[model samples]
Target chain A: MTANARPILETERYRLRILTPADATPRYLGWLNDPQVTRYLESRHRPNGLDDIRAYITSHDGHAGFLLGIFTKTGEHVGNYSMRIDLPNAVGTLGVMIGDRDHWGRDVVLETRAAMLHYAFETLRLHKVCGACLSTNLPAIYNYRRQGWAHEGIRREQAIGDGGSRVDVVMFGMLARDWRQRREMEQEK
Target chain B: MSAAKEVLAQAFDVSITEVPDDAGMETFTPWDSLGHLKVIAAIEEKIGRDLNTEEVLAVIDLASIEKLIAGVHRV
Candidate 1:
């Protein structure tokens, strides 16, 4: 809960901890190495080698926000979530990667996203937060919509993916004011 | 229509018709585990209020939702 040490963000069911080099192998490698896992990620094709992972860790060593390792109360590593600070824009881009298939369809991601959003808005003082996903990722798109992000637009065939194919990304965003409104409505209900 | 019905409909993306006449714990589909939090979020946004966990769970029907809104006004 302290600012310096990465604190555990407790929800009704799960806790999130900041990632470290020690989390490199089990948490990172487990997902980074899986083609199915990284299919929608920009770095999908990056060779999932130890050297590559080490470089990736170093690259994100002092990032403005964090790439956190999410866990259950029983101390099971479930997946990853990120809060990327865009200082120039005075906003943040939130991301989540849930590796455990068992946890899908349970709304854990939605709950976790909400918890992180609360922290981002209340603790970090962010002006806005946004998310993006492959146009084909229906679950992600649906979840984001349910979480109150607006569909900004789509990029047409902008990036090449693992198979030399192009993928269009659907973008979504929410301002602090809108988030506040949504939170207020939830409270009143 | 009660204020609670309006708020709940807007939040769950459902029409007023979707809510049953005897809607309670058994009637609302979106009133499930996850949707409950979202319903809470929508209510907070519409009325600019905060709800404690006890208050949120105490909500079982439209009347409770209206009561919560009324209590906020009283404060």
Candidate 2:
């Protein structure tokens, strides 16, 4: 399915939509290239042109699950949350990038993540959703933890960042059963 | 309910003699990363509803916790 074909999800403050070719611009591409943003990510190559971004977006599946563009109430694009499904493995990996530095500590990620987790467990029917963050990135780890993911140990010196430097990667995961139980409790209240 | 209170106490490791308004993430020590998960699990066991991760996060406090419990029955 095309990216737009997937149903849109809206929280009280954000509207998550699918990304399109129209979003591939120098302004958006610059965020992907920023060393600070890409530091924890596996890819180091910045998009050389729109063709690269378009290829990436079009290749994604909107039906099974894919990237989302997070927007504010006023319609500004804030960040993105994407889930890649591994059906055979019965799990998905969640990745988010808040392009706007201004919204970093505002709980937007928490809300966005919560929304995605809901979608993953209820709609996707996945067994688990997992995330990995660089050990040095305490905020990300802290965010993931606060949202109910369990610390699953670290990969010692497994990440290769810019300049060929090594960094430990912390893994976190949440089971669908755990997620459902958490939702159930919230309902009881 | 006494059971709810007991679960809250066990999950947060706090007395929570009464569900206080100020009773939030900042009030208790165990009300932390691991504690949040424990509390979610506790509530699930107590109420019998399976919460999604977002639902767990949305119930950020005792009041929302109560509301969530009530909402589940309507569904």
Candidate 1 docks at the CAPRI level of incorrect
Alpha-carbon runs more than 4 Å astray in model 1: A1-5, A61-63, A161-164, B1-75
- lDDT for each residue of candidate 1 in A1-189, tens digit (9 for 90 to 100): 113336468889899887666666755577776777777776675667666766655554334666777888998878888777876676888888888767766778778988788777777767888888875454676577667787787776767755787766778888878888998998998
DockQ list for all candidates = 0.03, 0.05
Model 1 TM-score on a 0 to 1 scale:
0.67
lDDT of each: 0.70, 0.70
**Per-residue alpha-carbon lDDT of candidate 1 for residues B10-59, written as tens digits (9 for 90 to 100):** 87888877766655433666665446556667777767976543354345
lDDT (Cα, tens digit) per residue for candidate 2, span B18-57? 5455455545444654356576777787678766433554
TM-score of every model versus the real structure: 0.67, 0.67
Against the native chain B, each candidate's TM-score is: 0.75, 0.68
Candidate 1 displacement at residue B30 in angstroms: 8.8
lDDT of 2 at B38: 70
Predicted structure 2, TM vs. truth: 0.67
Residue A90 lDDT in candidate 2: 66
